[model samples]
Target: MSNLIPDPISNVFKSLAIAVSLLVSLVAAPPAQALEPIPVPIDIEALDITSSIDLHREAGNRLQVSTAPGADGIVRRIEVPSRDGTNTNWAVFSLANTSDEQIDRLIVAPNYKLVGSALFWPDLGSSRIAAITPSQGIAPERQKSLEADVFLVTLDPGSIVTFVAELTTPNLPEIRIWEPDVYEETINAYTLYRGIILGISGLLALFLTILFVVKGTVMFPATAALAWSVLAYLCIDFGFWGMVFKLEGGGSQLARACAEVMLAASLIIFLYAYLNLNRWNIHYSHLALTTLILILGLLGVAVWDPSIAAGIARLALAVIGILGFVTIAVLAFQHYDRAILLIPTWCLLIAWLIGAGMTVTGYIANDIVQPALGGGLVLIVLLIGFTVMQHAFAGGAIAQGLISDIERKALALTGAGDIIWDWDIDRDRIYTGNEVEDLLNLKRGSLEGPARDWLDVLHPQDRDRFRATLDAVIDQRRGKVMQTFRLRSEDGHFRWFRLRARPIIGSDGEVIRCVGTLLDVTEERTAEERLLHDAVHDNLTGLPNRELFVDRLRTSVVRSKAEETAKPTILVLNLDRFKQVNDSIGLSAGDSILLTVARRLGRLIGQQDTLGRLSGDQYGLVLLSEQEPDRIVALADSLRKAVRAPITFGDREIFLTCSVGIAFF
Candidate 1:
């Protein structure tokens, strides 16, 4: 009992000795090896400090400094897991400087497009946080001029400092530690590559705009809009917009979201027109239009909340991809050649979208994602540009060939003494070949004026008719036109012309011009008149034949009955012994004697009377006079006396007698 109850001073001394031993043991242990000091100018990837780093997830967006070390959450691998938007990710790491000189380094979060804000805190310095964002104002501690979240870290020689990084981002953060030279080199390379892409995109947009102006096609403008939208997105993503416009807080993010939404909307519009959906499938076209409207509606949401709008934009992009694929498939099934050509391009675009989406959603690392996306964008542009140009210019090529062919044909026609004329209805101008002046026997350049000048050259009798025919052709949109009119030559002679024209219809299905050939038909008209005259007259004798005589008698009879005017009489005279004369003498001599008898009979009738040759030896007369019975007998006797006169035919005397029969109407 006396041993158990020890003395108070000895017990106190023993406890002190034990505490001193424990303290001495702790002091002698060499600080647990001080976590291998990181050398200066180190490669973050080679060092692979992620395994030794610690991560702490906070529940809210607010920044909170924790005095406790992040021992509970240590990252065991190089890959950093993604976090949701509701939480903040804090990465804790030790940056120990084992070098002889003080070293300054940059800790960069390269995925600036995804990161909202990044805060850096070093335990060695005054308890202060250096925060950086894409839209932050410039400061010495943060590299705001760059498009990345960059912070400067300085470490003294033989110093080990623990750092905490507060990252507010949905995607997995990529942190890189680099010396100034290496970072500058990397940034320069990135800038060069991005600049090339943006330049190409801008040029493409301008080209598409020019195409729209020239072609006046909906697809061209839609493609131009899409290209411009893509350019805007690239500008925003590459930090060019930030330099130009100081968009703070959510402004930059909202603009990016709106650009994405516009891009999707423009893409839909372009696809609609490019695929000719309205002409092919009306219902599908309506659906695409509705989808476009919805995509545009996302802008409103983007104005209110960019993150939500960005998510919707991604969804819209996915929907558009599906819709485009289905549309192309449907068109391909219908044997649309353009849709078939777009299949591989669309597939490539879909693959690129999937890869980009994965990168954005943190499923994939961002190390190669940005460059790949940029390269993929350029490739898609080239592929689509090639495809569109192949089809768009194909029709133009065909039309150019056709125009050349037409020009060749027109030249041949002009060489053949025909005039090729183009009537511009819109301007009311007439363009004729140079040969027109020579053909019309007019001064040079006489017909190079307005359409009225062309009309002035036409005969008065034909001008109105020609105008009417042209107007009808234009109004009715007739494919072919044929008209015969007379044009006045410089000699004041009217010459007939035959116009053969074809209407040149525009894309709007209106007749814009009439292209035709003018062929002079004056000789043809003269020959036709001669042939008509020959049909009515006798060949040997310059007198009307029996058919003409009958036609005149019918007309006279109808006039006499209708008007109760002077009556008409018809006299048929037959030459006696004509066949005997033809047998005695030759046929030529008989013909000569008949001509002499016809001349004698022509002197006996009045000017109003018509004398016609009835047969080889017979003659008929239609007298439009009031004749009584005795007058008729007298006329018949006079005709007989005229025929009874003897005539000399080729040194032979020929005598012929005529028997006359008269009829009255």
Candidate 2:
């Protein structure tokens, strides 16, 4: 180290060091200090009043409104109607606006029923009018403007009144209100969008239906068709789109009614096509027929001159919609395929159903009955479209690829399939995909338990073997094995499966995990058994024929010779008059005699002895040393006598006999 500099240089250097240290401290301390009072912008969403009120129109009077200036000489236009025919006379308009810095108290409105009450506060909702319905009170020093609907009598025979309210913001924040017209326009836009969507989805559904019918797409088309029908039903609001436009009057209401009828008809058609409700689905067809009948009745009522028909139709449509909803739910639950839809599906269903109900109720209550499921429909269609796209491109989309794999696996094992699972003895948990539940008909809620407990599902005969095999696999530590065994399906049906698994080893060459897949082998096993039967047995008679008989004879002889060094008695047999039986009674009768003779021979043989068909009507038996050939001959004679007795096939009797041949080794 060098010596310190003189006073001026040392002082300057010390100051610089202190300055650097202070700067560094300032920089380092800021982030922590600043984090102390973190600013969090909480998004706020508030709900307020929205009700449809009829504004009655007066003819030859243009509806008008005016407001007197305040004490501060501030006079703004209070809302008034542009003179259209309606029952709504006036309405009080209010909005809320506040800065984070200050608490703003809003003094607003006598929200009471008044004749000629209509206000124009389209600005109120646009400003996100956070309205607090304050009681009649004195105005505060810093008061906000309170707008109300007013009517100025004017020159028209049939003029409708609309109230306009405005909150003129003077350098203050603004919030919006849910304006009726704006909402209407928005809903109309959404409905239009829904129309376009319906067009595309309808075409898509039609295409799929045709393709699936031609291609025999099995289950996928049905699921896809149902999904499409749901989309259309939701967009159509079960036909409530008709009522909203009908509010404009003239042919509009009729158009709305016709639209409803068409939608209902279309809905029935969709159900018919989608569910194939015509032929085998008798119950669904009946239900659908009833729904169509109701639709016809509703249509008749709606067209029964003037408004009463419409009212009745509206009510009927609501009822029909509810019924259809129940039907759809039952079908979906039964199918449970793509059946288990997420929230959007429920939202769409409820929106249309609710809209239908509201249209009916609103009509009876004499309120402005615009009961279209507009926004909700928009939300559903967009979501459903997105969902469809996501599903269609599932394999390509990274986020959805994994999900689709799981879904497909679950779907594949949905019915009439077996799921065989294996667990590593070392690993505490079992590994199987979602397919396990579908295969086993298990609720996701019911799948957890000890691994060995699953042994209960195995057939009693196979359980011991299964357990032994598992133990062996575990003991061996790193072997791959494929095993066939019997297990119980969810429906209590027994099924065979072939399961295979292997252990994944760690870097230390120790088995860390095990993985496996299961395949249902019941059909294959049955086919294999059939092949074995075909190969070994005579087709006409149910007996162990030559190949198997000879094999059994050789096995018994070898076993007998090696074990006790005893001579095994062998009795060879032939039907004594089989040729005569065949010539007299025909081959079918001869077959019956052979069957009867085989049964007799089986009864005559002891439990330990073996018997088999040697060839044609010839047979053989192997007995232990204790059994004699003479007794076997007697047994063969008894079989011949039994065959000589009356044999029945259809309505005929026949007689037959077999020649006995004896041998000893």
Per-model lDDT = 0.71, 0.50
- What's each prediction's TM-score? 0.50, 0.41
Model 2 CA lDDT for position 212 = 46
Summed backbone clashes in each candidate are 0, 57
lDDT (Cα, tens digit) per residue for candidate 1, span 262-348? 878888887887787888667977788788888899899878876677677777787788879988998899898989989999999
Instruction: Name the candidate that leads on TM-score.
Output: 1
What TM-score would you give candidate 2 relative to the actual structure?
0.41
Q: Which candidate is the best by lDDT?
A: 1
For 1-665, candidate 2 gives per-residue lDDT tens digits of 86968899989999999999999986874232100111111132222223321122231122233322222333333323333323232333322222243222222221111111111110111111122211112222322221211111121122111223222221112122333344346547755765665665566566556544544423335434444644544443323333344222224334444444545555455445433445446777777777768766655655554244444444454555566556557667777333244334544656665654544333223212232344344444445445544444463233322345666766565543645354544555665555655666766624345567668777889888877876676667778867888868789987787878886776766665666767877789999999989899877666777788778778878887788554667777776767776887788767777777778777766777767777777887776534556665676667567656666767776555556666767
